[model samples]
Target: MTITVSNLQPIIAILAGILILIAPRLLNYIVAVYLIVVGLIGLGVLRHFS
Candidate 1:
């Protein structure tokens, strides 16, 4: 199986939804981390490592 940028968003959203449902208090941290990760990926910082 292969993963691509186009396919990552929904997977991340689903996971985030589940996490928020399980622990509402973690919403802030989860969103912050998700944004940071997405930003890094967008900037191609993570592509090199992968």
Candidate 2:
């Protein structure tokens, strides 16, 4: 099973949703980190790692 760029966002969203539901206190940090990581990925900074 391969994960493409198209599959990344929804997966992240779903996971974030679950995390937020389980721990409301983590909502802020989770969203901030998620945005940062998504931005980095979009900008190709994390391309090499993938």
Q: Give lDDT for model 2.
A: 0.83
TM for every model, in the order presented, reads 0.78, 0.73
Which ranges of candidate 1 are over 4 A from the true structure? 48-50
Give the top-scoring candidate (lDDT).
1
Model 2, 1-50: lDDT tens digits are 77776777788789989989999999999989978877898898999534
Report, for every candidate in turn, its global Cα lDDT versus the true structure: 0.85, 0.83
Q: What is the C-alpha RMSD of each candidate to the true structure, in Å?
A: 2.0, 1.9
For model 1, where is the 10-residue window of minimal lDDT? 41-50
Clash counts for the predictions, in order: 0, 0
As a whole number from 0 to 100, the lDDT of residue 11 in candidate 1 is: 85
Per the 3 Å backbone cut-off, how many clashing residue pairs does candidate 1 have? 0
